[model samples]
Target chain A: MSTAKQPDPARRNERSRQAILDAARELVTEVGYAKVTIEAIAARAGVGKQTIYRWWRSRGAVIFDSFLALSEGAEGLALPDTGDIEADLKTVMRATVAEFADPGFEAPIRALNSEIINDPELAAQYREKLAGPVDEAKKARLRSAQRAGQLAADADLDLALELLYAPLYQRWLHRSGPLTPEYADALVELTLRAFRP
Target chain B: MSTAKQPDPARRNERSRQAILDAARELVTEVGYAKVTIEAIAARAGVGKQTIYRWWRSRGAVIFDSFLALSEGAEGLALPDTGDIEADLKTVMRATVAEFADPGFEAPIRALNSEIINDPELAAQYREKLAGPVDEAKKARLRSAQRAGQLAADADLDLALELLYAPLYQRWLHRSGPLTPEYADALVELTLRAFRP
Candidate 1:
């Protein structure tokens, strides 16, 4: 049970990590963030508690990893980089609409994000595991478009980045509105009109 | 303790409700949401628990009502409705930045919003009491601006609403970036540009 990220040794270790993540994800979905524990995850994964502690700090950290893995496997989830910035953004946003609609990824992520609001340590893990990569991907796309003169040269990339992605996250978290495919296209159009000058 | 809005004959009940709201807001700031109870609110306001609960559903509901009252009193806090859409939006958003910076409002609000994520009933109360009004205020401003020819006639008001407000909410909830006055100006400018044909 160490806080350090050690190098993986063999295929067996990879299998064990996968099994542990799977079990933890399932248990958290079945129970919840407050109720899921190392003992339950161990029993489900057929591993010792120390096995989980070997690579993660707490249940929050393990669940964060599980969400990251799930996001990785989701199809059409990447920010597209085709030369047409409008088309690429629409493609990515549409993909996100589908991803958020998926049961496997949405429920656990929402539950974890809900917890992060009150827990500082878990909130940090959430920003690192969830917002960090997505933020980077979006900034890269905006920068590339600006560089190619598709977007206004003076367009603030960070503002554009936040503008494009924030609505999706808001809808997903608040359950305030439908992130339908039509909504995705409309968002893209609005963003492009704003960014294109 | 039941959940129903009551009519006050002498307005004694109205005064009591305001007193309870004031006490709840003050105590929630000091003690946080989880510890702010019906009994404490009653004691602080010199009333009984049934007196407090005669009008609202739960502690979260009372806290939410208090938050709403605070926002509503600051008359300048509503979205500005000058014929110049950009300037009006910037005025409203700048005011929002000031509100976000106010510790008296921000601390208790942060605590209460965090707790609501885990409580669906509270979340519903929150949406109605807080989110719904702010959203309605924005829509009304947009409508007036559109009518004044400050915006395109056919702009999709619903999606436009998301574009203007969701980014600020997302940043506030996630602690992803600074919700500065500059960012607010940027949002208004970006949204205005998007509406251009």
Candidate 2:
């Protein structure tokens, strides 16, 4: 048999990187962020500790990267422009509720979220990587709605955005209630009325 | 010396309980929740582990009791009936923002909140001991506003209450933004507008 072409070094490196991220995600979910260690990730990924260290500085960094990778592939919090502002917002909010309730995403997300609350550096990283982009996108959508005369011109978009997502997040973090589609719909309705011209 | 009033057993027990709670609070603040063990708390309080275990089942329970005790002495979230619903809400919200920003309260609260998010039993306990009473008080105030014609009769008080507090809690949990008095004021304005008749 013809000798198999030696796998490209670049491809091998990428494969190892992806494997390490996947292992981190799995371990964070299975054993939790508190219990997950770099050694455990290296062992689970079947890579040398040096290899992981070369790529990521710490367990938090690895998990954060993995979280970004996972979210990038999922249906993100993009507000669709369906011309009907209320309907578009409802769609986005319902999608958010679904995302929060997703079992595959919940545990690791909660662990990371809790860590972010307690660690200032990680909070900054999270705001830059995730919250900032999402906030800007929603604000842009709200400005468009305001221009269309669907919402009050002077409505505070920043507070408006908080109104849209904060309730769902509170329910999730506090375990105070269910993050159901109906709950999402209610938030959208109340927020729309608040912003109505 | 008058024998120190015979050192009544009841008084001694109360003193020990207070000391244990004080030690738990200080340890949680100093070393953090993860590092604050029962043994460490016992050593710090100059009490035996059995004394702690006799009153509370876990370190979380001790911390929870300490949290309740600390909050009991602080200015609570009482809604004043100043005839103007907006001002009353603003006062309450501003108090919330101040409480959140208190440096002495921040670390232990964050640690306990994160733990509550992760643990189901602790979450339920938190809801009952803290969240439930607060929610009911706010809801009662909203109902009074409805009766006074300051707010819409059909306004969903439950959702309105969420609008009032969810943003504050979200900022605290996500550490995505500053929990400022201005932020609290903005929430009050938006929520009142949403509920206005």
Interface RMSD, candidates in the order listed = 1.9, 1.2
Model 1 preserves the real interface contacts to a fraction of 0.64
TM-score of each: 0.79, 0.90
Candidate with best lDDT:
2
Q: Say which candidate scores most in DockQ.
A: 2
Off by over 4 Å in 1: A1-20, A32-62, A72-78, B1-23, B34-62, B72-78, B115-121
| Deviation in Å, model 2, residue B81 alpha carbon | 1.1
List, residue by residue over A56-113, the lDDT tens digit for candidate 2. Answer: 7777788888887876723355578977898998888898899889988887888788
- Interface RMSD, Å, model 1: 1.9
lDDT of 2 by residue, B1-197 (tens): 78776878888899999999899999888887778899998998999999999999888889878887776623355568877788888888898899888878887888788778888898998888777777777887788888999999998787888888888888876766788888888888888877788
